[model samples]
Target: MNDLFAPRIAADPSGWNPHLAAVLADLATTDAVIAAQLSKWAHGWGAPFSLGSVPLSAVYATHVAPWNPPEVTLMTAKTILWIATVDDWAERDDAAPRGLDHLQEVAEGKAPDPHSALAGALADIRDTVLGAASSRRRGSLWVKATTALLAGMKFEHVASAQIRDGGPPPALPLYLHHAGQTIGVPLTMATLWASAPQPACDSSLARLQPPLESASQAIRMANDLQSYERERRTGDLNAIALGASPAYLRTQIADQVRHCLEQLRPLLTHPCPDAQALHYCLHFVLRLHQAGDAGHLHEREQQQQEH
Candidate 1:
């Protein structure tokens, strides 16, 4: 992992923004809340494999903070845990399509098996997260984002199967487009919107289109860089496995990060505080992923401690 992303990681402390540092610190303080939520969910769902591997503190610090309302932080934390657990499971298991189908059914408002712990837990998360939306439009947006994430998961399952069957890696453009959705950026954005100070209209969100795409691409590249080795060993389809050299992948990731930051700069000056907060939150997560937490979960606790 270091060999693939050393250059990108080495340039990071300088790229860190001070304004977001305070927000991140505040987020880190939510560790107790996130941990409590995770503990409760673990007791009910039997603990995801990631419970021991990925620090809940680090996840909330990167994914749920800055925009999370104090009242709903616990719900947000649970949602993040659900997303991470489902994502890890899908990536590691060959039978993921079955699980994805179950989750999609639950997300679509189908009654999950009352006896199935995983299905029940997923339904609870879907309801609680989407239920917090202030308006039907925002709720629908959250549902749409979740649907897109599931679609991306199915696409990844197909790509992973192709790789295992000795087919070529997915085309670069195809990977990036699908990876953006698979990485959960859209869902995260929907969460941000749902928790924003005011309802975001289509036009307001449209203004953020460029930065959002840049952020998604940056996240995809960072994830690919950090996961290349493990993904290769696991027969997963990664951007790096598409025959790109380490140096070239590093350059591409750097370029994406720069573009993401550039696109976000103007949004920082937007009249809406939600728009500005969204920009900061997006940058915060991208920086965390670029710093290697997205794939290298073992280091997350240490990194957060140092921060």
Candidate 2:
């Protein structure tokens, strides 16, 4: 096994945020600097392998929320682990190499091969974040399998083995679960830290901060969706009060159309490749969100004319 493939232990037990304020302070002064830092680190981590396929940007965007499916929780944890590993190295001004060249260099550092080295790093990250215990191994396995695929690795045999052995899914780590509760805080702080205080370009960098701009948008959309759902329930209740006739069923269907729009608007706000990819995967949901509104309006017109 290559030294690079060896799972060296990383020290982040407390997972402290002491550097947050400093990062934000620096970013308030410079706009492109943090992005530059990320790019640099990506280079050092080595040639873009399948692991680079993990959508760090989307992870940053939505991973902070409570995931109904616990797999999402693990996915976020693994992605953050990768980011933490590379980000510190990326921040240095002296790191000259950029893009694919830098990644290739980093990948070539291993004795055996780049692919296996990356696989080991990924496996190490899973063990680190999930904890090292026999009880947790199953959960760790699931995360490792999913993360490897996301990063662009193929481990079909391992994945099939996991499915065969699976019974109940494991609980996500406590920190990752809580990370959703405090969703926008780190991202907001990070953006603030990385940006210059003054406007870096013609426009204010502060204005474009993802946390500042999108968090509120996300919250509002979430709220609107909730309200839409409540109203639909209320409409159903009213229909039941009137009696569940053909008209009542049609009314409930119309309600669904409006509810779908509320859901889709938030998703479209700041879409990236990962988000778009996920959206495509949820084609049925997307179709409902897109077509639902027009259908609702038409139904409303028909209902009004009949009345």
Question: Which candidate wins on TM-score?
Answer: 1
Best lDDT among the predictions, by candidate number: 1
* Residue lDDT tens for model 1, 1-307: 2332335534468688888788768667666566666666666677443566336433543454445555455555555566777777787777788878887888889888776565787788677766767677667777777777887888888888887787766887887788888876667667656644465444466666676677677667777877787787777778878876667767776676567667666766655544564556555565566556464666566767999
Query: How well does each candidate superpose onto the true structure, as a TM-score?
Result: 0.78, 0.23
Residue-level error in angstroms, candidate 2, position 200: 43
For candidate 2, lDDT tens digit of each residue in 1-307? Answer: 0111124436664875667656645433332333334344344556432233233423332323322123333334334444433332222222312321233333333222344334445444344334432233334333433332232211112222333476322222321222222222232222212211111221322232332223322222222232344334432111222233434333433443344334444544753322232223223222223333211345556766999
Alpha-carbon error at 220 in model 1, in Å? 1.2
For candidate 1, the TM-score is 0.78
- Model 1 stretches with alpha carbons more than 4 Å out: 1-28, 47-49, 57-64, 200-203, 271-273, 293-295, 299-307
**Stretches of model 2 off by over 4 angstroms after superposition:** 1-40, 49-63, 66-117, 132-138, 144-307
